[model samples]
Target: MSAKKRERPPVPEILPAPVVDSHTHLDACGAETAADVAVLLDRAESAGVTRVVTVADDIESAKWVVDASTWDSRVFAAVAVHPTRTKDFDDAQRSGVERLARAERVVAVGETGLDYYWDYSPPDAQQDAFRWHIDLAKRVGKPLMIHDRDAHEDVLRILEEEGAPDDVVFHCFSGDAEMARRCVDAGYVLSFAGTVTFKNASTLRESARFVPRGQFLVETDAPFLTPHPFRGAPNEPYCTAYTVRNLADLREEPVEMIANAVRETAERVFRLPTVTRG
Candidate 1:
């Protein structure tokens, strides 16, 4: 005899709502097709990630990022030479970045800066490339996005010596309280990412506590550092919610306050107009 199948209990949704992913790499996300971007964006939007700033590490990637930004209003662009790719900054490279900076979608000049941890490029070369990007940011009147890894001293020194533009963003900030204090005092926006959610990310959390509202932001740096619950999995813009949550908890603020601060900081530094909230 066939018995009626019993209905399963409905499971409640557990994922957080969307927030802005201030830094990511859409082109480098390894998405295979237009449908891929569509799927990614859908997940992000559903998770509360309303916007993303896709960073380009080289001229070619920068062009792709800019093009993608044009096609998707929710995405923006940041162009630069990563410390690991300092050798790529030749004449043509410089010209390409300059042209892209003038593009309507190019909002900042980075994920550029020092990376002593990798040392893929000589320290001198990294410094030179960083200086070049900083100069270009000033020339183009755009904010400077930085990537410092085990090279905080050099990064801070260079920025100070070069008179870095007023709009400076220390993306994926992992420095300690002192560096955070210094950066905040210097008017630099500290952009926390998934690393802030790691069990051993006390230093980063402390730094986040020191950064005040209107002077802090958050990012996913997708395809990397997928936060705590999702660690070891591929990260996406939607995962920025974990970072925002961790930051809010660390700063003793409400989740909405954290989101508002991050949104404000991004708009101020990138010169983006106020976002339309739903």
Candidate 2:
């Protein structure tokens, strides 16, 4: 057996307009310290990605995002136990997450939803946690960022049954055009990642085309899902430009247009903070 080869594409030119990475994992990206975070964010800023919403897939990550958001004006936080890890969700963990979710800079409740692809946890447990997170988001009056994988039907069903939060985002959207239309009709925002740029992702590209400019967002989901020509490479927020540019090309729209749309949508949904202190 041999190790699979990965490509590391050079960073593309900076985007013309600033954009935001709606779903990324700062800690997983190896930005464990404020200094490391600053360096990563600086590279992203130089590439015109001025803001980011770091998401937590577990409790420790949830805590980290909350603390990191306070350190960097450009960072916002989204906290939740991911679907695969929802097996660990309990009263104590929920209480901690709830306390942090109400923190000044925590903007959304998520990276939570259903993932049938990986059976790390049983289906019912995942659903239970998903529903709980939904309730928490509604009560807190914050947007919900969903992580739907091979379980789209169940994910949507749960949302409908629970009366989804006022603002819902499908981070790293992985559905076909029809699902995209449904999400748009239901007022859910779809966040695109580098996967949309892959050759085999025609359905994703179609879904992107079907999305109205204001209803879609762009993200890096960094430390994973690197864009085409660079797929399999370690990802970072600075690589957001590549995904944004590819999205623009896919939609046959100007790069600046896509950038501005995502940036504005992110600000509205996540209530981004100023990148500099007043």
Which one wins on lDDT? 2
lDDT of 2 by residue, 116-215 (tens): 9998999999999999999999999999999999998999999999999999999999999999989999999999998999999999999998699789
CA-lDDT, candidates in order: 0.81, 0.89
TM-score of 1: 0.91
lDDT tens per residue, model 1, 1-278: 12221221122122343356889988768754556677777777766677889999887788888888877677889988788999546888888888998888889999899998886799998999999999999999999999999999999999989998979999899899999999999988888888888888887777778778988888989878778766667678877777787788887888877777787777777777787465
Worst 10 residues of 1 by lDDT: 1-10
Which residue pairs of candidate 2 clash? none
Q: Which residue runs does candidate 2 get wrong by more than 4 Å?
A: 1-8, 273-278
Local error of candidate 2 at residue 197 (angstroms): 0.4
Question: Model 2 TM-score?
Answer: 0.95
